[model samples]
Target: MADRELEEIGEDNTLLLVDDEEPFLKRLARAMEKRGFAVETAGSVAAGRAYATARPPAYAVVDLRLEDGSGLEVVETLRETRPDCRVVVLTGYGAIATAVAAVKIGAMDYLSKPADANDVTAALLAPAGDLPPPPENPMSADRVRWEHIQRVYELCDRNVSETARRLNMHRRTLQRILAKRSPR
Candidate 1:
C-alpha cells in the first residue's frame, strides 16, 4: 500500500495517535518509534483533529473513547481531509457494532487494546483484509512447564521468579522458555 496519503503529502510516514489512556500511549509510542515511525500523540479527539488539521499524518491510530470526545469524530475528519491516509481504530471495549461502524465509515481496521507492535504494524501496512501468517506452533517445550509458567506469568505480568515459585519449578526453567522466544 502507498504509505503516503497523497501525491503531494510526501513520505514522512508520520503517525497521529489518539488515546485517552496515558500508560498505553507511552508504551505504544515508544514501540512505534522503535519500529521507525514518526509519531505524534493527542489525548483527546478534538486535539487530534486540531493536530491533523495543522499537519496531516500518513497514518492514524485512534481510540474509540476519549476523555474529551468520541474518537469517531477524529476518524470521520481524517477520512474527509486525508482520504488516502490509513486509519486504524482502537477500542478498549471491543464490540462488533463499533467495529462494523468503523469499517463502514472509513477506518482500515479495528483493534482491541493491549495489542502488540506486530498487530499495529500489520494493521498499518498490510492489505486491508489480509492478516499475517500465524507463527509456527512448536511443541519442543513440554506443555506442563509452559502452562504452569503461563498461568503464573499472567498473574505476575511475565515476571520470572514469581511464576516459577507459583508453578513450583526452578526460575531457570521459566527463563529458558523466555530465552527461547527471544533472539539469540
Candidate 2:
C-alpha cells in the first residue's frame, strides 16, 4: 500500500525530524540519513514549518511541545499545505488527551519520548511500509488512558477521591476503571 502510494505520488522518500532538543534532533537526523532516508532537522516547530514549507518531506516526526508553539500546529500546517505527508508525533509529556488530539489532528501515530533509532525509524516508515504485523493492542488506547489517569492521580498525590471528583466521575467507577487494567 505504501509502495503504491509512493509510486502514485512519485515523491522522494524523505523524513522530517522536528524537536526542541537539539541533540536528539541531530542524532535522529544523522541516524535516519545513515539508514538511507533523506532527513531534515528543525530545532523548533516554527523552523520545521518553514523548512517543510520550502521543501515538503514525505513523513514527519513532531514533538508535541515546541519553543514557539505546540506540535499540533505543525500537524495542522502539514495537513493544510502538504496533505500527503504523514506526521508521527514524538512527545516526552505523553498523555491520553494529547495522543488522541494528535491523531485527531492528522498525526499518523504518537510515540513517547526517549525513542531510539528504531522507534524513530518505525514512526517514519511504518505507515508507508515496513510495518510489523498488527499487534493485539495496536495502540493500547485503554492502557494510555489508564496511564494518563494514574499520572494525573499521582500528581494529585494519590488522592483518588479528589481526582475522581475533579474528573466528575464517581470514585468507585474510577477505581473500577483503574482496577480492571491494573499492571501486574
Candidate 3:
C-alpha cells in the first residue's frame, strides 16, 4: 500500500523526521525507510532547522515540542527552502491552537504522538484538500479524556492540585482518575 502511494505521489523520496525522543525517532525513521523514503533524522530543533536549510526534503515529520524550541521553526525553514515540502507536525501534546499554527506555518498535516508509520505515510501522500479516511480504531471518549488529563498532569509537573486547578476538576476526583489505569 505504501509503495503504491509513494509511486503515485511521484515526488523525491527524501524525508526528514525530527523528534526529541530518540527511540521513537529511530523506529519511525526505520519504518519510513521500509516504506520507501530515504529518511534523515534529527533529535533537536536546531539540528532539524540546519538540515532543512541545508537540504529541504520532499517530506518531513517533526515533533512539535523540542528541548530547544518548537518544531514549527523547522517547518518554517523547510518552507523557506522548498515551498513544496510536505510537512507533518507530530506531538504528544495535541491541541487545537497548535494544530492551527502548524497548518498556518506550512505543515501539510498534524498528528498526535503514537501515530503509526502507515498513518504518517497516508498523511504524507494524500492528495491536497482531501480528507483522510477515518481511523481503523478511533480512541474511545474515555480514553481521550484520560489522555487529556495525563497530558495536563505532566504539563503541571505531576502536581495533582495544579492539574486539577487547570482542568477545573476537583482535586480528589483528579487524584482518583490519576490512580486508575488508563482507558482503552
Cα lDDT listed for each candidate: 0.77, 0.76, 0.90
Instruction: After superposing candidate 2 on the true structure, give the runs of residues whose Cα lies further than 4 Å from its correct spot.
Output: 1-11, 128-184
TM-score of each: 0.65, 0.65, 0.89
Against the correct fold, how does model 3 do in TM-score? 0.89
The digit string of per-residue lDDT tens for model 2 on 63-172 reads 99887888888788888879978788987667778989998888878787667776666665564554444433333566556667876786677888998987788999
Summarize candidate 1's per-residue lDDT along 56-113 as a digit string, tens digits: 7888999987877779889888887888888999875556778899988899988865
The CA-based lDDT of model 1 is what? Answer: 0.77
Runs off by more than 4 Å, candidate 1:
1-10, 131-184
Looking at candidate 2, the ten consecutive residues that score lowest on lDDT are 130-139
lDDT of 3 by residue, 97-152 (tens): 89999999989899887799989998998889999888887778898898889989
**TM-score of candidate 1 on Cα atoms, chains taken together:** 0.65
Scored against the true structure, residue 66 in model 1 reaches a CA lDDT of 86
